[model samples]
Target chain A: AQSVSQHNHHVILSEAASLELGCNYSYGGTVNLFWYVQYPGQHLQLLLKYFSGDPLVKGIKGFEAEFIKSKFSFNLRKPSVQWSDTAEYFCAVKAGRNQGGKLIFGQGTELSVKP
Target chain B: EPEVTQTPSHQVTQMGQEVILRCVPISNHLYFYWYRQILGQKVEFLVSFYNNEISEKSEIFDDQFSVERPDGSNFTLKIRSTKLEDSAMYFCASSRLAGRNGELFFGEGSRLTVL
Candidate 1:
């Protein structure tokens, strides 16, 4: 079984500040990584995903994540953030072959972007 | 874009009672899943359904739980007897297929409260 670890439990940032959320998984084989955000009253929305090829992947709203195979990490980042970004962020990973691939999610990090 | 939708934003059930959580995944999606998140805990995978059968499930999905797609559109999870620990946010997700390219789309989630 795979386990996801997200070190940052809560993060507070001012508008325009740089952002980074650490995500690490336990599996060593092939895996798919994703970042999902849940605003105060909205559904979970995809931030970005990483499957293969390039280690760095860009997502919507200027968000990006880098898959570091050696570290077993795929950390989410953004050069700058806004007040609208306040939400709960979850990092997930799906390991092994695709047949009914299920996600293993981290404990989630609550991010508050102060205006 | 297409989206997954869930019913009864919030549900309260008594201990030992049965409760069903409903979901309507996006059209054309072939894989469906149910995940639960206990307060302040990681989101846990419950079960995955495809071709109208369960393809995969986690230890968290015991005999007390079952899934069904009665019609072409509605997918449901039934807890035969609710327990206090069953209180959590239940999220429904669907994808085009299992494995490699299966980027899941999730619903707003049904907050279940067992009293």
Candidate 2:
């Protein structure tokens, strides 16, 4: 079956540190990729998405992700992290043929930014 | 800005008891979805609905689980007989379009604890 994998489970970084979270998917067809974030006590919210365009997609909160078709990867990155950036990040993919737009999500990566 | 809303922020129920989680999706959205995240696990898709019918469902959505858009404003997921494993955070989401390219808006989830 198709699946999404996030390599890091927990990442700790100091404020202003650069960050990257790895994601890979196993679908063989066209895909729509997304990154979502959940802050403490908040609902899941979209950070960025990749439909079909330039491989580099920029999202909210100074976050960006690159879709590398060859590697089946869409990795999230941030240049400078803030203490407020501590949250759980999830990577998701939707197969092109799926009519319902159901998403397959990766096990989330928890990032803790210490001040 | 319009957003999805879920009721009963938290619920605790005995195993085998029936439970109904409710949601009100953004008024303009055409597609509705249900997803769940078990404690310390990845977010998993449960089902998707459109045009008053189910568009798709995952294996996790079995006979014990059912979804209904009972009215113009209310979407509900009913678990006929909850199991201990059913304890998780249930989220409701909606999108303006199908899988091609539409951002999903999610509601604050309802945390269910099946004791």
Candidate 3:
């Protein structure tokens, strides 16, 4: 079975601080990676996705993720985060072929950016 | 922009009662999906529907749970006999295609509270 693991449960940062959230997946075949974000009272929205292109993918709201196939990791990064960027982030993966595009999500990471 | 919509932002039902959560996926989407997030737990995929039938389902989607696209636009998840453990936030999503590469649009979740 494919599973996603997010190393950070909660992260606190000051405004303008660099941020990186670790995500790892256990899947052997080809996979798609994604980063989704949920504001306090909003729905989960896609931030970025990686299918078969470059390893580094840029997303909305100044977010980006790097897909490292060898490490089985796709980590989210932001050069400088703002207080408005505080939200819950999720890492998801879809195993290629035969899986019917089912996305397995990791336990979310709660990001608190202090202004 | 078009977005997925779900009804009854919150639902409270008794054990043994049947609860139906409704969703209206984005227009023109070809694939529908249901997922649940228990409080303090990871979001888990329940089922995926395509071509008016179930294409894939996780173990969490057992005989007690079923999904249907009754009309042309509404997709629903039905729980035959709800249990306390069934209490969670249910999310509805849709995509234009089915594959590792497709992106899913999710609705603001419907919270289910079974007592």
Candidate 1 has an interface RMSD (Å) of 1.3
Rank by DockQ, descending?
A: 3, 2, 1
Q: Would you list the rank order by lDDT, best first?
A: 3, 2, 1
Model 2 chain A lowest lDDT segment of ten? A93-102
Taking all chains together, each candidate's TM-score versus the true structure is 0.98, 0.98, 0.98
Give TM-scores of chain A for all candidates.
Answer: 0.96, 0.98, 0.97
lDDT of 1: 0.94
What lDDT score goes with residue A81 in model 2?
Answer: 100
TM-score of 3: 0.98
lDDT of 1 by residue, A14-115 (tens): 999999999999997889999999998778898999988999999999999999999999999999999999999999998976536698899999999999
CA lDDT of each prediction against the hidden true structure? 0.94, 0.94, 0.95
Tell me the spans in candidate 3 whose CA falls farther than 4 Å from its real position. none
Error of 3 at B115 (Å): 1.2
Local lDDT at B50 for model 1: 93
DockQ of each: 0.78, 0.81, 0.81
| lDDT tens digits by residue: candidate 3, A1-115 | 7899999999999999999999999999989899999999789999999987899999998999999999999999999999999999999998857757689999999999999
Kindly list the per-residue Cα lDDT of model 3 for residues B1-115, writing each as its tens digit: 9999999899999999999999999999999999999999999999999999999898999999999999999999999999999999999999998886569999999999999
User: What TM-score would you report for chain A in candidate 1?
Assistant: 0.96
